[model samples]
Target: MKLTIFDCDGVLVNSEEIYLAAELEFLESIGAGFERKAYMQSFMGLSPGMWEAKLQTCVEAKTGAPLPRDFYAQIDRISTVRLEADLAEIPFARQGINKIAILRCVASSTPSTRLRWKLQHVGLIDLFDPHIFSGDLVANGKPAPDLFLHAATAMNALPHECVVVEDSVNGVIAGKAAGMRVIGFTAGNHCSADHGESLLRSGADIIVENYDDLAAAIERFARPH
Candidate 1:
């Protein structure tokens, strides 16, 4: 059976912007000099723990005080509030999901607790299999292939038979490294000004702008070679 793995944040829940905004606000509140453009460039697709450490270092350097352990807690609180206030639906996600016949799962850099809550809030929790593989579950996260490999194994599918839908360069790299066909989703504005070329260079076989295109790409991928 063919397996399809989805990246959770930008691809499913429109949480990328929410996350960036919350991070910036939190960093600024803690007296960290946050430049949105720079921060996005560096941390857009990094695992939560990596981002947290990077943010802490930045804050420490700027404020001359080590970032509090609760800094991430504050950011999570802000993220939760913002998500509740402006929960966004990925364009055509429901319809596209209904069209797919492949076994599906989520492979995300988000922690399981936050990932489940986001999916639940967006009414998409039931659409995927119970096994949602988070980066924290693996020794190394995205760009390491561990999460995608783990998801493929859980779905009982060979890596070559899996198609990964991702919105970030790191995720595309991970999918490719895991031996899956990677499709980059550009609709969420996850990439920089180059649109999806960065993702393409990172190893995405195809880059789509919307769920319609995403569905079409999957259908094509499932076709006999």
Candidate 2:
């Protein structure tokens, strides 16, 4: 049996814009103004810890002011509120998941608590609970292969028998490094104009823009060569 690994934020839920909105607001509050397009292209797949560090450096660079250590917490609080007010699932996620015949689980960079909360909020917890894996459990996040490899091991599957469905460059890179097949997903609102091309260059084996195509992609991958 093949193991299918999913990325939560942009691939399963329509929450990328929620984080972007929260971050953009926080940056504006601190005197930084970044275009949404640039932000998504540069940082769509970073873990919160990494993003916080990057944002701290950015705030200091842009405004010539030391960023408060509490900035990350503040953004997390804001993000929670925004997500609760406006969380949505990708249009065809349920239908697609119902069609897939392989074993699947989520492996995300999101902290375990937030990951559980968000998936529960969207009613997707049942689909992946007990099998949810977080990068928080590892020393490194995506683009490093730790999280995916960990999930594969937990599921008793080998790297070559796994297929990663992701929407970000870092995730695809990590999947490739882990020796798994990678499918780039671009149906989310956060996808850039060149999202597919970027995902491919970063090492995705294929790109699927919607869940219907995702089902087909998986079936195609499962066939013997």
Candidate 3:
């Protein structure tokens, strides 16, 4: 049997932009300003703890002060409001996923509570709920093989029997490191012009621009080589 692993933020929902905007706003407010591109390259797809640590490091370097104690709460407030007002699934996600027959689960950097909340909010929880895996479940996040390995093991799938669909370079690296074939997803609003190239360099087996092509990509990967 084959298993498909999906990254939640950009692959299933267009929520990456919401989180990034809130983070940038909070950072600038605290004088911990960051360039958009640099921030994306450095921190996207990281587990919450790692992301926060990196932001604190940036804040210290820029302002000689640590991030405020309420930094996460504030960002959470901002993002929660935005998410309630306007959370959208990636285009074609619902239709594509409903039609696909592969066994699948979510493996995301988002914490368990927030991950379930976001998926439920977008009406996708039923699709992958009991199978969802969060970054906090493992020792390391993206760019490390731990999370994907954990997910695969829990789902009874060998690494080689999995196909990971991810939108970030770090996620792709982790998938490949776990010995799974990966499909780089670039249909999210947050994807940059060269995002596909970045994923390729990081070892993605294929790049899919929309969920429509994702099923085909997985099928192609599943064919005997």
Candidate 4:
């Protein structure tokens, strides 16, 4: 791979658990509930704005209750407080990143400010500061390929020359659609039991259960033909 693109929340920084817990707590506060695994499966890669716009019905269907008007605000408040205090880097992710010979960057569904906060808080900012990009950079997010394509262009690499490490199905679909090889990561606390299968179904080229194996996966799966 000539370029390595990483998703932020779960792949680069270990914040998915915090995000999921905050979301579930918000749902509880609103008297709505969801089956945790099902929620992760259906909404793992959505941004906060997209979550409200796109998954409102999904949440209602899964929880058997409609979302409150304040759902987004509450979820955002809780998640911001929690992550600002507790965001941490993924174990071995930095080690694996450092071992790679290719150029690298981050392309996440997170908004730019929040993405920077988490990465800087966890001391990962220096590794990809200037190159970090958010879904807001494009007209569409994951499952549409715009964000990944934008990342590839900004990094001066073609889609076929990039490898994406992602922890969610939408991300895998986006990477594949952008013509990059994707490695599905199940190392996050929020990963469902069937996460790997879901990502594979969405077009991941490889599945990695831990950051320790990410470098090898990139080598094996993202090679030029």
lDDT (0 to 1) per candidate: 0.82, 0.87, 0.88, 0.84
TM-score for candidate 2: 0.94
Alpha-carbon TM-score of each model against the true structure? 0.88, 0.94, 0.94, 0.92
Query: What are the per-model numbers of colliding residue pairs?
Result: 0, 0, 0, 0
- Candidate 1 achieves a global lDDT of 0.82
Worst 10 residues of 3 by lDDT: 210-219
Best-first order by lDDT: 3, 2, 4, 1
Clash pairs (backbone) in predicted model 2: none
Give the per-residue lDDT of model 1 (tens digit) for 114-155.
788888888898898596888889988777899999998888
TM-score of 3: 0.94
lDDT of residue 29 for candidate 2: 82
Top-TM-score structure, candidate number: 3
TM-score of 4: 0.92
lDDT tens per residue, model 2, 147-201: 9999999999999999999998888888999999999999998787787998898
Model 2 has how many clashing residue pairs? 0
When 1 and 2 are scored with lDDT, the better candidate is: 2
Candidate 3 lDDT over 68-145, as tens digits, reads 888789888999899888898898888888866789999999989989998998889899979999998998988898
Expressed as tens digits, the lDDT of each residue in 112-160 for candidate 4 is 9889988889888998979999978988777778988999999999998
